[model samples]
Every structure is written in structure tokens, then in C-alpha cells.
Target: MAERSDFSFLDEAEATCRLAMDPAATGIDLCLILERDALLPAVESIDAAGFFIEDVAVLDVAEGYQARYHFRRFDTKGRIELRVTAPHDDPHIPSIANIFQGAEWHERESMDFYGVTFDGNPNPARLLLPEDATIKPLEKDEKSRKSYLDLMPEFTIVECAEGHPIEELAAKRQAEREEAERKAAEEAKKAEEEAKKAAEEEAAKQSEEAGEAG
Candidate 1:
């Protein structure tokens, strides 16, 4: 069997989301808990790292609506899940259709079934339900709904440490990304200069050979 991909990188990606749980109990490789505002950046990072969306699912829980995005890489043997929750009264999560075109259909299907609104979805029309349908057949009654945390006991929900709010984490992450970009640019420039020098040296050596031949 192929070795499982290491997800220690997610610990460094705390800017995208809180690295909440070990997915061993959850049957996945990694589970990331994201706030609504961090969803796009997290997904963007996932996409940049070569993972593709496997599916987008919504759960109607007592805490509210839980949006779960499953991601997997073609070259890897592990799965990563992104979880975000919206209040029951406000079941709105940002749509990732712009980042992953395939998510448009999945979001529409969730809208039809669970009444979860995927904000910014290009086409939010019903996918399987009738155009005039208003009732979301999959929405459970309050009594029937389960607590989000209860369903996912593996998640470690802890209060943010003093002076390290989500906003601060996000800002730090941005700075780190900018620094990485700057270093990459510098490296590329250095490589280009070295290549030019090598080319010039080759040309000088060829000219010397030609002069000797003459």
C-alpha cells in the first residue's frame, strides 16, 4: 500500500482555519474547522496545493447548518475535509463556484435539499427539486436535529488564546505569504542572472575555439 500523505502542512495553514482534529477517528486524513470568512482563503490554499473538491455537503444540525467540503488530490492517498458552520436562522455560506466550477452544481443541490444558501453561487436554482418548490425536504425539525459538536466529537473546540484572534492569525498568514512570494522572486532573479552568465561564458569559450581554429 502507498504511504499516506503527511498533513503537517495544515498546522502551518492555521491562517486558513483552525487545525481542529486528527481525522483518524473520522475516517479521513485531516479535518480543518473554518469560520465563514476563512472559507474562501482556505479553499484557495487547498486548490493551490493541488487538491480538488470531491463533494460539498450540508448538515442540518442543532447548532445550525454545517457545510462540509471534501477535498482530495489525484496524486495523494489521503483526504482533507473543510468544515464550516452557519447559524440555523442564517444558513448562508459563501459559494466556491468561482474557485471550483464543479461546486456550483453541488451548492445548488444542497440549496434544494437543505435550504442552505450558498452566497455568490452563479446559479442557485434548484437542481433536483421543481422550480416552484419552496420546501426543503431534508431540513429536520429542531427536536430531530443533532448538535454539530455531538456529531463530530473528534473536533477539539477551544477558546482562542489571548492576543491571537482569528483576524490576527489571518494577518500573520498574509504576511508570511507575501514574504514567501518575495523570496521566490529573488530566487528566480538570481537563477536568471546565473543562467545569463553561463550563456555568456559558453559564447566566449566558443569564440576562443573559433579564433584558435582560424
Candidate 2:
């Protein structure tokens, strides 16, 4: 039988949510719910505790997107889940790419399919979607979406120790998202221009060939 993990330290650290371990039901040792800003720090804590990143997964819920990070310890027989939700309008989370190099592709795949932005990821380009795909294939319909705030309104949102408003962080993230959009637009424009140039050149070559035949 797998031993139950001692996750009391997370409670002391003031985690947003501390669900007891149920390896049988959840197939994991612990579940720690973290506020957006606290995610990076909590992940660093877990890394320091000798856990390795297993996979980054996301779910499209009514409230928004839930980002679930699975971690496991190779030396020990233990695993844990770190989960956080991002609002649909501004679905952004700090990327763990720096901590786990393999997370780059995982984050990209999530971004391509769910439109969730993993902030701080060195490369945020589409991983699986066609260059022209604007819609996230995995996004849920409006009628089915659930409100994450409604689901857990009682939980306190963690803020910076300096008392920075969550709104400020949200705004900063929104700005980053806007910047990424602008860059994508520019790249798209460049591609269009190149395509037009190529088409014109091909047409001219065809015309020259016809003239030679005449």
C-alpha cells in the first residue's frame, strides 16, 4: 500500500486549499490548491523537496481553465498535484519551463489547444495547431462553462506580501497577453506578405514561360 503523504506543511504555509490525500480515489498523494501568485513559490518548494515534474494538464471548466501540474518523486513512491484556475478572459499562469525544461512543449500544447498562456515560457508559439487556427479546439462552449469563483468563493486569494492588489497582477498579465497577441499579428502579417510575394513571382515566371513558348 502507498503511504499517505504529510501535507500539513502546506496548510501552515497558508495554502488556498488543502485537500487530504486519497491515493486510491485520486491516484495521487496530495492535492494543494494555490493562488496564482503563490504558484511559482509553491512549485519551487515542491522542487526543493525533491519532486520532479510529471506533466502539466488543463481542463476547460465553467469558471475558466484549471491548470493541473503533476509531480512525482522517483526515489520515493509519492506524487502530488498542484492546481490553479485562470479566468477565461485572462487565462495566464507563470510557466514552470525554467524549472522543468520539458515543460516548454507541454505548455505550448496546452496553449495551442486551450488558449491558456503560460507566462514566462521562453517559447510560446503554437505546438500542434495550424498557423491560421484562431480558435482553441479544446475550449468549452458558453452554455456549459462553470464559474470557478462561484465554486470556491470562500477561499482567500493569495496576494503579494507587500499587499499588491490581485487586480494589479491581473492587469500586468493582461498586458503581457496583449503584447503576445500583437507579436502574433505581426508574424501573421509578415507571412501574408511573403506569401503574396511568392505568388506574384510564380505568376511572372509562368507569364515568361508562356511568352517563350509563343
C-alpha RMSD of candidate 2: 21.8
Alpha-carbon error at 115 in model 2, in Å?
0.6
Against the reference, the lDDT scores of all candidates come to 0.79, 0.76
Residues 1-214 of candidate 2: C-alpha lDDT, one tens digit per residue: 5454444455554455554455665677666667789888888777777778889998888757899899887666667778888988899989999988878999999999999999999988889998778999889898877654333312223332343333344456668889999999999999999999999999999999999999
Candidate 2 ranges beyond 4 A from true positions: 1-14, 146-214
Kindly give the number of clashing pairs for every candidate.
Answer: 0, 5
What C-alpha lDDT does candidate 1 achieve relative to the native structure? 0.79
Off by over 4 Å in 1: 12-25, 153-214
